[model samples]
Target: MFLDRDGTMIDEVGYLDRREDVRWFPWTIDAVRLLNRAGYLVCVVTNQGGIGLGLFDEPFVHGLHAWLDATLHESGAVVDGWFLCPHHPRAVAAEMRGPCACRKPGRGMIDAACARWDIDLTRSWVVGDRDIDVMMAVAVGARGILVRTGHGERDLRKVDLSLPAGTPVVMDLMEATVLILAEGERRT
Candidate 1:
């Protein structure tokens, strides 16, 4: 399964740059544990524009991810990988200020994850809280579930009319996990 980091797994604190600010949602650990136990390769694909904006550096993001991994480990949940795009159109750093394929709505990060992990996009699922998250999944032939957290509810209101029909909308990751697990069982 592919997941969004901010808003989807952890509380969306705008441009989270501090490890002390990390806050997991009530259902995060359990939902991720369920995915791990179910044999799903859970990976995080996030757009960390803050790095480009000069609010934080890549090392900061890595540190925060390390903290996340350690915390999840304590609960017997493992994140297979983390893919982040630190580019933005108006970035403070020239190198990071261009259009990049790894950004959300782009397939670079997802494609890289697939290659590194041998993921089957056809059977994969993505859970996120924004339209771009779903768009990324669609770009790679995966199913998407949009959760109503952080920017989710607002993003839902602004979703393009062209979004795939029947894309599931749920209250949060917990609900999405339940739906995915149930579907997996049904398919089996």
Candidate 2:
């Protein structure tokens, strides 16, 4: 499964830079463990414009990720990998200052993960808290689930009309995981 990090795993702290500021969402570890047990890769795909906008550097992002990983490990949930797009069209960085395909609403990161991990996109899932996450899943032929955490509840109104009819929107990660697992069991 591909998951969005900010707003999805951690609270939406508006481009969080410091490890001290990391506020992980409730039930994150248990939800991740459930997906992992269900044979999902549990990778993270996130957009960090703060890096490209000079609000924070790549090292800061990495440091925060490292801290997150360590914390998850302590809780018996491990993230498989993280794919981030640091570019923003309006605000560019000196090095990261260009249009890149790794951003969400684009399928570069998802495609790259599929290639590297031999993921079956058609059978995989994307869980996020934004419309961009839905667009990413649509681009890659995966199922997109919007969780009402972070910015999701607020962003729901902005969702487009093209999503599959009756696509489920859950309250949080744990509930989403339960639904996904139940659906998987039904299919079997």
Candidate 3:
């Protein structure tokens, strides 16, 4: 499974530049633990455009990920991999400017995860709180689940109206975890 970071796993704070702002939803740890126990490799794919926008540096991103790892570890949940895209189309940071394959709706990060983890798109899933997250999954022949958290309610309007009717939309990560596990059982 591929999960989006902000708005999906952790609470969405616009341009999260500090570790102090990290907020995990109440159900995040348990949901992740569930997936881990179920033999699913939980990978986090996030678009951290803040780096390119000069809001934060790459060190901040790595530091935040480290904090997240420790936090999740305390609860027995483990993320198998993390793929982040720091590039943005309109960036003040010269190095991070321009279009990149790793950004949301782009498959660069996802592709990297697949290569590193040997993930099979046919049996994988992408879970997030935005249309781009689901669209990324669909682009890669994987399942997509949109959760209603953070910008989710707003994105919900678009997802419900725009995404294929078959796409699954849930209340949060906990709900999404249940759905994914159930779907796996059904496939068996």
TM-score of each: 0.96, 0.93, 0.96
Cα lDDT tens digits, model 1, 26-96, are: 89999999999999999999999999999999999998899899999998889999999999888977889
> Residue 39's C-alpha lDDT in candidate 2?
86
Query: Which candidate should be chosen as best, given TM-score against the real structure?
Result: 1
Indicate which candidate wins on lDDT.
1
lDDT of 2 by residue, 57-171 (tens): 8888887788888899998897888888888766664557666788888998888787778888888888988878887988899889988899889887764545566667889
Model 2 per-residue lDDT at 156: 74
lDDT (0-100) at residue 124 of candidate 3? Answer: 94
User: lDDT of each prediction vs. the true structure?
Assistant: 0.91, 0.84, 0.89
- The count of backbone overlaps in candidate 1 is 0
State candidate 1's TM-score: 0.96
TM-score: the better of candidates 1 and 2:
1
Ordered by TM-score, highest first, the candidates read 1, 3, 2
TM-score of candidate 2 relative to the true fold: 0.93
Collision pairs in model 3: none
lDDT of 3 by residue, 108-168 (tens): 9889987777788999999999989988998899989998997888987763556656999
Question: Residue 105 error for model 2, in Å?
Answer: 1.0
Off by over 4 Å in 3: 159-161
